[model samples]
Target chain A: MNPMNYVILAAILFSIGSAAVLLRRNAIVAFMGVELMLNAANLALVAFSRIHGELNGQIMAFFVMVVAAAEVVVGLAIIIAVFRARQSISLDEPAELKG
Target chain B: MQSLIWLAIALPLASAAVLLLAGRRADAWGHWVGVAASGAAFLVGFFALIEMLGKPAEERALDTTLYTFIPGSDLQVDVGLLADPLSITFVLLITFVGTLIHVYSVAYMEHDKDRRRFFAYLNLFVAAMLLLVLADSYLLLFVGWEGVGLASYLLIGFWNHKPEYATAANKAFVVNRIGDIGLIIAMGIMFTTFGALDFATVGQLAGNASTTTLTAIGLALLLAACGKSAQFPLQSWLGDAMAGPTPVSALIHAATMVTAGVYLIVRSAPIFNGAPDAQVVVAIVGAITLTLGALIGMAKDDIKKALAASTMSQIGYMMLAAGLGPIGYAFAIFHLVTHGFFKAGMFLGAGSVMHAMNDQVDMRRFGALKGAMVVTWVTFGLGWLAILGVPPFSGFWSKDKIIESAFVGEGWQPWVFGLTALIGAGLTAFYMSRLFFMTFHGKARWTDEVHPHESPALMTVPMIILAVGSAFLGLFLAVGDRFSHFLEPVTGHVEHHEPVLPVPVIMAATLILVAAGAVFAWLKYGRAEVAEEAPAGSLATITARNDFFQDSVNRAVFQRPGQHVTRTLVYADAAIVDGAVNKQARGWASIGEASRKVQNGQVRSYAATMLVGLVIVVAVIVVGGL
Candidate 1:
């Protein structure tokens, strides 16, 4: 019944996803962490929508899933191109973008 | 409607326009066009003189308003031409002498490649000088004033291929601009005090203004006069200005343009009449310059430079007279007209000598030229006699009047000015005779390579006409106080006053001093075997040779200090003004350098930074809700 508990769960999941993205060197693993963060946000939204007696959060979660699917196709294609070019898909391998 | 007065200025102006715009295409006939334009302007001005003479003195002034010059809510000025006795006198002098000079230049500048440009500038000078005399308002007069200044600069630097000549031109322009500042400030005061810039309105309302305002205007006009007339402090340029063409030295520097200052003073009779302090200052400046010029003239070995010094001294006499009030205004103009003749003739004579001697200017290099150039000698002799104030000659009539008028004031004023004038007369005689004897009367000093011959009739004819004016113009004009009566409507009639000394006694003393001076010069440069090289002499002689070291004094007094101030300002600009901007720029750059660390190409670092920012925002929200 407590919507605050949902926010707390979302916070914990976001922390874990951020740790995976920051700690992992593989580009695919970091991308998977981004998907985890989005799912955690969706979970929090649904919990809030139920507490407020609305279906808006569920509709937004479906929209986010569709957007995430499109993002994965483009991001994965970019990572594969990077692998072809430099023989690596690690995030740290693209140091050409360094300041 | 003497609207035809504008034609006097327009013809030459049109010629100048055509020659300047046509460029090289006008070269073939440009000089002839220039001569014709000047001649036509003379005719217009000559007829205008006749028309003016037909009217009574009061009705002689014909004001022709062409259009509005500057339209304003509070200050409206008209571009008008005034044909009056005073202006007509100047017009006849300018146009007549101007035409003669133009004709002389046809031969004088016969071979120069830039002869067309030379003629264009000469025509431009004639038109501007005519406008300066004919303009009905101060604003309009200033336009002509600046026009002549430009014409003068162009002509003086006509041979700008030479660096020194260009520098001389710049010197003249810069000095004249300094004088022009006084005119501008005077006009500003006129606009503020009288609510108008036109001559008539200001003249009528000048009495209503305070003496302080009038004095300010008077001093300003004097400064302008000093610059234009080459009097005192502004005189260094006159000697250098001989770098211009011979006709230019004759026309603008000697005759017309330089006298614009005297004209300005005489024209603004009302303002000067109210400011006695300003008048005294003017007279003092005149006296000092008169003596200084004579001294400088005595030492110059260059014929043109010597004559330029003489012109300065002669103008000083006019200025001294001008500063004496209405009593001396007519005499100032009288001397101006006659000096316009003799000095311009002598300059042309110098030109003839130069032309004959293969452009050699040193008097030591010339001698016994009188035999080769008879017509030049006779005409030059006439001008010498006329300037010496010899009896029945022009200067005796005109210059003596100025000398007499300079002695008309009260107290020690007459003594100082009278003594200065007398001393100046003696100095003039010595120097001018020295020049004449050194050139025509002494043993031949020229080298075999240079053959002295008479110039063509084109040059001699003008010298002849000017010589005639030098000899008879004064005698005819001064026959019955006729010149004074003609100028009375503008200058106002002043009853004759006895000078401090009896006129006859003063005249006798002046003649005696002149004789003594001529005898002295004869003994030094004529009777003795003159040295081919100038021997280093006394400090006094060296001082005169160096123009009294005026340039050095000016550098020390104004230029060096000005440079220092400018340099200090540049340093301050770099340190204080720019320092603030540079400091801010460096501060921002350092901040940017620090911020660059955050943009490191590390996806893991960026994600960690974003996670920390998200946590901070969520914690703030949670604490606020609790």
Candidate 2:
């Protein structure tokens, strides 16, 4: 009923997605979680536009969705390459990216 | 004539370079080359001396610049030769005596494998000695001074196979370096005070210098002389220097290089004239050294070491003479020349004796050699006579003149110096007679295997020539007081004096004491049963035997402290210097190890750390806003 409820729901979704990305061992699941986090941000942007009665937040949300599409294309390609080379998509197994 | 002066040094230097460069290729004839080079230098010097003498007395000095030795904005030194009465006299002495020694070494070193190298060093020594006398400026003279010292070191250690011989060379070098400090400081002071280093300029301006400055310079020069001439405190190295070859002992140690200290004092007469206190110190040092050297000479069984001690005493006489102002300079040089002839002859004779006796230097093992080594005996006898100040011998004219001058001043000064010199003369006679009797007069002491024989003709010829000089040189030079007159242009006239002890009384006293000493030595050791080793008898005998314990004193004073300081520095360098660096590296390594634990190459750990930092930043921002 309140516009704040949508913002709160988006924040909860973002936290869940971040937790999945951090805790998951599989590379494909971690990538999916990242996309979910981006969508949550887009939802918050759209809700904020509605609350302000302006088009600025909605436009930012549209740009973010485009960026998410591009990110998905690149991210899937990298995961597929790593899976072929190592025969595994576990983030813990391919820990070469860690400091 | 001026241009030809350079040839005196150049000839021997070129010979040295050629022989050294040719190496083994020149081995067959290198010694001949050295001989010929020195001979040519002698001829050049002889002609140069004649030409110089032909000039008017006041016009005899010739200063010719060869090149710019050192060039700078504030200081400039020319590499030039000064051919004056004083320098020409030295040129003759160096070249003539050097030529004889070179020829003598040819035969003396015939059996040695390193004869070529030996000759090369000899030539180098002659060239440097010539330059020392001929140099116009203090800076150039210093170059020659160091040159001679280097040549001496090389020749002393020529037989480097023997460990002690090398040690002896090192000892001579280190001791000389101590003396060189005085010379270097004196030059620095002269440069500051006179604004010049040329002999003529310094001599002219030194008269106006403050007495304190003059005294410092004079004392500094005396220290240099003490080192080179082998006086008192520095006398220890001279005896050790006998470890070198016999020819080297003759030329560098006895005749030429050792006398350079005397030459330096005589040349700087103007400076000494201005510093009476410095002159007094010089005389005292001479007196002490002469007695010390004589005492040491009496105790040594080694023939070369005894001669070395005697050389020290003789140079001490020259130093004493040089200390007496204008009157002493001429006599110092006169004594230097005579002493050069006799001392060189005696050293060569010692070498000849050693050659005959399987190179054994112990006089106790060398008795009854008079018939076996006739030439050595005859020549050494003449040298012994000359050294004892016997009339008609070279030492009488020169040494007597010095003793006379030592008593010229009134009061206790004359009495002390005159009595000291007289006593030194007696000591000289005692030790020398002791050396002679022990070596040649006593019953046969050599083992059955020893077969003593005369040296080859080459060695004896030089000895013969030097013997003749030692016998007749004084009479020839002192006739009409010509030597003193000849040196007058440079040294100025010495004020005539009424003697403290009448001249006849002094001469009679010296003669009587010398005779008594000879008789005493003869009775004590000449007729007594000579032992393989002199018994360690009284405290005086032990002190003399130990070279007055000077070496022990030096070990305690300088060497022990130096070693302690060095050890402490070494520990500090390891503990502090290295520890500081190692501790810093260890600290960084521990930090790296702690940081490495955070980099476990795990994605979850890195993410957690990032989140924690983010939460802290957010909390701070929120708190500040509230």
Candidate 3:
């Protein structure tokens, strides 16, 4: 596959994910959108590295996976706390600090 | 020898430190500490003067550069001292008069609860003034300049319990800050143009610089001087400064702070001489101040406030003289010294009157106390004579020189100066006599609770000495060649003018003017019948009483704009600035709130989202990378 085609696909996926994250009222949809954006960025990096013949992209992807795992642990803990307090999962209703 | 200079600075600082450390306990001994410190400083100044005089003229211009204070490619400033004729003269005046005022304050402030703080502030003022006069560079002078302003703020609001006094202090400090901006800009210009801030170096550079650069520097310094000296528009604060104690009015207004502007111009005379345009501006500003101050003085009923206006008027004469170039420099300094003696004495006398009359400052409430306070009466009479440029008194001689130089000098400059000085003299005599008659000559005006009496020797003694100085100090100039010879090396060229108007002619003209003013005043206000008659509600009286409409104009123009700026612009801008920052904080807070909602209490939803996220991530990477 041409690296350019992979890069184009990744950019499209990232834009779609960002739009989903911004527009969705559901917390679960937003979480999936964020994960899709991160994975799309990782895919773009891997494609560029393959075309350039560098190990640096592979190393960066490995670190991204580790960071994503750690983020999941912290995010779940935060979700559990919020669930205990609010008894709802609506992102729109959660904006209690807005002007 | 260096230790002597250090001692002059250290004594006052030490007193302040002791007062700060001892706090209220310092009150009992505070007066004595202040007196001793200032006395010691005066002695050092005396020694410095003696040493300065004994040296060859070349040796008299001593420069004690402390160190390079600022290290930069473009500019460097030195913390230094210049013991030239001008600085020496100012040092002697500040230290000597400061000592007397300190001693007088010991008695004047005896009943006050915050005597320690008063003494501390007074000592600090002396040190700051000494630093101001003794500093060799503009930067060091500025340090002392601001230091004096700080001390003035503390001293003016010594009775901090009074809201008005506190407000007056704030007004003085803020007005002075406005002037300080001029000094700072002048400094920056000096660095850019000359690469030095030392008076001698800058003076040397000013001689060679283009007229435009010199004019820029001169104008900047002139603005600074106007602010410090309270000239024209910046003069309102001096009247309000009467809210301070009487001695403060005496020391700061008469002897020290107000003279700083004159000193700055005189010290930078070379810069001014190089830029004749700037000198004209100085002369014109001086003339305006003289006219304004004298007119305002005519209208004041309060004795201290009138004298405050007189101080501004007298400083105007000095500024006028300074603007007359080299010939006027000596005259300005001479007038400055003589004015210090008489002005300080007059203010002290006014203070004595207030002290006797149950703290009543309104001259309308005073009359026929000349017999009761004999010393005050005599000393103040001499001061009045000296200030009015009366023949045979100190003011007459100095005023004569300034006026004569103005007419006799190059071009039409002399005529312009002479004319203004004449009018200023006439008005000065008229107002000063009015003040004297109202306070001392007529029937007793105060009620039973207020009885006039003599102040104690502590206050009267300084007045007596100052009276003598005011009467005789001007005679030193009669031997002009010797005086000029002594000052020449420090001042560069001393322009000597052959008396174009014969001494007899000048003296006769001045004497006639003086006598005319005195006779007119005697007829108008001095006679018992005239004084007994209530002042008429004539337009002139109303104008004089209203400070010739200048105060109203100031209120409408400057004061209102200033208030608007502070209340509307500054307040609005501050609110807007703060609002912008607060909005950003709110935005961040809202984002945090939105993020918090994602963790709502639903385990099933969280699990489903995690699975969906996993599938999306896997699909995006696999499909995109294929």
Predicted structure with the largest DockQ when compared to the true one: 1
In model 3, residue pairs whose N, Cα or C atoms come closer than 3 Å (at least 3 residues apart or on different chains), thus clashing, are A83-B600, A83-B601, B406-B414
Q: What are the lDDT figures for the candidates, one per model?
A: 0.92, 0.90, 0.83
The candidate scoring highest on lDDT is 1
All candidates: TM-score of chain A = 0.90, 0.94, 0.90
lDDT (Cα, tens digit) per residue for candidate 2, span A6-88 = 99999898888878888988877878788888889888999999999999999999899889999999999998898899998
Q: Write the per-residue lDDT of candidate 1 for residues B534-573, one digit (tens) a residue.
A: 8897999999999999999989999999999999999999
- Segments in model 3 whose C-alpha atoms lie over 4 Å from true places: A1-99, B480-482, B498-503, B530-536, B562-598, B621-626
Q: How good is the docking of model 1, by CAPRI class?
A: medium
| Model 1 steric clash pairs | none
Grade the docking of candidate 2. Answer: acceptable
Report the candidate with higher lDDT, 1 versus 2: 1
Query: Stretches of candidate 2 above 4 Å error?
Result: A1-21, A28-99, B572-589, B596-598, B603-626
> Per-prediction DockQ scores?
0.73, 0.42, 0.04
Candidate 2 clash pair list: none
After TM-score superposition, the amount by which residue A59's alpha carbon in candidate 1 deviates from its true location, in angstroms, is 1.3
